[model samples]
Target: MTQVRVESPLATLSPELSAQKLLSRGQAVGGVVVIATVVLLLTLSATVGFGPSVLWYGQFAVAAVTVVYVAVIAFKLAMVFRADGSPVLRFEPDDLHAIPDQDLARYTILVPLYREASVLPYLVERLSALDYPADKVQILLLIEEDDTETRAALASMELATQFEVVLIPDSPPKTKPKACNVGLSRATGEFCVIYDAEDRPDADQLRKAVLAFRLLPDRVVCVQAELHYWNPWTNWLTRCFAAEYATNFSLSLRGLDRHRLAIPLGGTSNHFRTDALRELGGWDQYNVTEDADLGIRIARRGWDVRMMVSVTEEEANSRLGNWVRQRSRWIKGYIQTWLVHSRHPVRVWRELGTKRAVAMHLTLGFSTFTTLINPIFWALFVSYLITGPKYLEPLFPPLSLYAGLATMVLGNVMMCYCLMNGCMERGLHRAVRAMLTVPLYWGLMSVAAYKAVFQLLRPSKRHFWELTEHGLVSHEA
Candidate 1:
């Protein structure tokens, strides 16, 4: 039997909504306006003395915003412990038993692979353990046309009856989202999910997601399971990575859910209503962080994305170089998502309402901005500490200097505190000690942020997907 190739033009489906091109016309105009405004302010500042310069007031404004953002971070950290009940959907043993086999919806599992042959056997074993009815599920291994290694590896394996191999035709923009779009076109189920090659999800995750969707409102079209690492104790890098994921998935996202804000979908373990996903045009193939982009689009269309209490354990990148390569791509995609969504702010506000729109910016745009500007603040603080605030007085002022100091010191402490609590919540107690050294992880993130910025500036590298090699670390922890 022969399989026909299928694809979706998610990135370009709507020219105004896609990040296929670096910048839309509206975004370009917006960028120009922002630059011009900054230039005018700087020129006015140069005309005035440093004490009362417009730039000084501008610095004050930024510092004030930073203070507020830090406070929000602190609040989210607090929510990690203080929230009365789980903000995300949680099911008991009886809840799983309540849904009969015949009542379950047809499911599609898409695992897009490129040069990931090493993990094929383990991936298959783990996926086969899923609790869904075997006859009702369709498992698609989306391999690229040119990935001969993975294809040859699959050829030798005796796959289950429900498993099918989908060879995505060789194409430009060889990204995971593009392969996923291909799989989405061929999905034959009421619900669909994407799992990476190295993921080991809880056996009943699919069932939990199905039940969650049934219990939630019709507008809730997606359920995101929490993502943690299978090898959190692999090394310092992996430990830090685990702590970060704990904070992100457990605290930050759940906090957003509690407040009815937009929740960005994780890279894997995101289950979606097939029809709703297709209606949203799948994912942006050109965007490196397609999950984040899709999540925003879901919010913009008045749809809700909820988090399920299930877990998907992935192999964290333990190697430093591999971690940076992966993180840089993520940060780069975040930049792309921010720019793509910020093109039409007015329409977004009208669609998502004022609160959601603001939340989206704080989630996407402002976070990216903060990551990019963090080094600048760090350098200034270092200078302040070494020079005793003498040379930096003009720029910082007395009040602004203290405010900036407070934001820096308190923000890092709150983040570290959140990570520690996140570890405890997830039962990664050993990783709690590593949270103190998480600042080193932040340094790596800044390194990745700069790399992402450089990649965004270069046309050829903008959409390049840096592959993170898996199957190297033992899953002992």
Candidate 2:
């Protein structure tokens, strides 16, 4: 592929030359278990009048944590509201007319796979139909060395000149990041992006991303385009999934981009500068949510991420078991990322700055923690309303009790309103009614969070990558 706009080229650092990637088998799980055990014992001792003279200290500690959690949730809701008030920078076809075709950049595209042969043909067709110059675009079809079935399908493809097959050696963590790293090692373009086998990116997405890179400051090294499902109306489940994604991409992430805060990149369609990516040693093969971990790493190193106006359509997992497996892996990865960064709190705080460090905790840490523990609080809140106030009243003082009532009213209302507005704003009008069933959707997420925590604690499935089956529906959004 022909290269383009190689500015201030930093020397590429090979995998062998860089420090070994951190895999999350022993570090996070063991450390987390020890911390949890100590906290539990302290709480128990306080309740039994063995640790503190101040009779209410232990219960106060728990209440204080809950107060902080609710406060942050309210703050996040404010960010979304503020984002809606601000203007969004959108690119249209007229804007794309300024750049000449001769000046267009070459971009390397990677599609990592394990056993995705069933969808290879549709993937090839979509990639081939991208609006960018064909000669400047090179797709690296990455397959594991042992995946003979996918390899056979690749051999049969007619667009041999448009793509190249890269065989990755068998590795301990058979993750998407590992395959992406192998593809990155062989990438020959000035800019690069990744797409799953089931994605259909907007035709002018590359152009908008290229323009964003040229127009934005040098510190902005990556651009994330919007991701939404194509078959949003396939079922009730898919509608909720689509609404959740729409709110995150269009509303939540826009705020992060506006304030120059780092956002966890979506798994696909994140365009990056080759030199900057190499400077950071590529993706972490150990972290399940490598995109998010990499985003935080970029911010710590004094770089920024931006959001593009274009969209990439993906297949929504319609099946219950498939959605649960995928969601659990994602939540587990977020936990891994939080633990790895929190290991050196002082260093990370100094590097990421107070504002971004807090944002990172709210984005990664709070999400996993809330999902894992929401059920317990929900039970308490429900009991207070349905059964009687006598059940859990003594635990919380007046201030904490008032705050809990406020959060319950404000949080649930904000979430439902957010989903409805997000769907309507994105022209996904069909999903608004699905908001009525969102509480049930959240319950399922908690179920996945429990599974994620269990898997992270266990020794056997710590590194397992449960693949989500795609190509179930063939609709275009």
Candidate 3:
């Protein structure tokens, strides 16, 4: 006997499918704009040269800048390698045990959610399973008041008694930092940590952090746990994203801490001393990258932020469009942070000391410049290739060209080494694949960089939060 099965109406028209279609349309538009801009720039560079000599001069200038930028990055990498002679912190298998019942401290875990209903269940389960005492931990699910759907979802959860929901009042410049501030006001813990909705932090992440804090002195005001992704194999985009983060958090940040420079706070699993944070007025609402901005402020005020050896796992954006949106926001925030700090450079130097101030600028300021100006280099390169020596003569002579090429090659080698080191540290099985995607990763970054520049120019036009979807990994499995 044959039976006919009927499909549910809602199953035929899934909301997830609809949202993905909308996202794809937006991404297509963005890609078109980027392609158009690149074409226009290349055409202008080729045709607008006043004369052969002038064209060569412009090319020379571009080559010189590129060479200098690469050289600086290479130098920084060398310094980082030399400074990290030994591990500043270390963790062992036993460190994964639950926090001692007698020694548990009141810890606040703040998770700021905005239109994140899809991943809320996974986030809740991850938090509930942490190897910390349920009674000692206070998990605040910070949600914007306008996000009623997410709010209702939280209400439906049979959450532990320790879990609570805090609604952020609608305010101008609606941002994550503001939501964190609302959570901060209601927090009643000795220590606090920030986690995003997609985080699947190690069960003992908090336990390890607590132990480190107790061992260190009171001056250590914040502890940043190492963050890595669990789904690097999802696609090339995810692989590259994992590599980039591994280098940034694992190598660059740890090196900065070794040199006693201001280490920018990463977005998640950053445990803080509640008193210290409250004293600084929580996070700066105006700074788009509030985590980085707050880290610097704490350092300048004579507090220290340390790095925990423990690692937290999170999802990497697997889709190209999602990756671009996430990267654009990061670049935009970096630009905002740079402007805010550079407004009074001399004063900042005096407060943070010359060495620290220079380090901060080199890392943050140089990062922003490198990303924003990357497309210019590509444009000039394409023009030079098309027009041959006629277009290249004005930029640089043969000797300078050789020097530029050498510097670029050396810089890339160094970056590759750093990325490989990150992959090995995180136990990534496909390190070679991550290395191969470096160029594609850079191309995506170029697209995001242009978008970020546009956003910076008309900051008022940037309002919507391009939230990256999570829940790609299942906890039960």
Candidate number with greatest TM-score: 1
- Candidate 1 residue runs with Cα over 4 Å from true position: 1-4, 7-12, 40-86, 475-477
Cα RMSD for candidates in order: 2.4, 4.6, 10.7
Candidate 3 least-lDDT 10 residues: 1-10
On a 0 to 1 TM-score scale, where does candidate 3 land against the true structure? 0.83
Measure candidate 2: CA RMSD.
Answer: 4.6
Candidate 3: clashing pairs of residues: 56-393, 56-394, 56-395, 57-394, 57-395, 59-395, 60-395, 60-396
Q: Write the per-residue lDDT of candidate 1 for residues 1-477, one digit (tens) a residue.
A: 123456544343587777778998877888899999877777766876534577567667666767666755555565565443546799997889788999999999999999988889999998999999999999999999989999889888898888988888788889999999889888999999999999999999999999998888889999999999888887899888888888888877887787777778899999999999988988888899999999989999999999888899998898999999999999899889888888887888998889888777777767766777777777877877788856667666677667767777887887888889888878999999888888778788889999998998898998989998887875444
lDDT of each: 0.84, 0.80, 0.73
Runs in model 2 with CA error above 4 Å? 1-58, 85-89, 385-387, 475-477
- Clashing residue pairs in candidate 1 are none
- Error in Å for residue 315 of model 2: 0.8
Error of 3 at 195 (Å): 0.8
What digit string (tens of lDDT, one per residue) describes model 3 on residues 245-339? 78777777878778778878998889998988887767765456778877787777888888777778888887778778888877766666665
**Model 1 clashing-pair count:** 0
Q: List the candidate numbers ranked by TM-score, top first.
A: 1, 2, 3
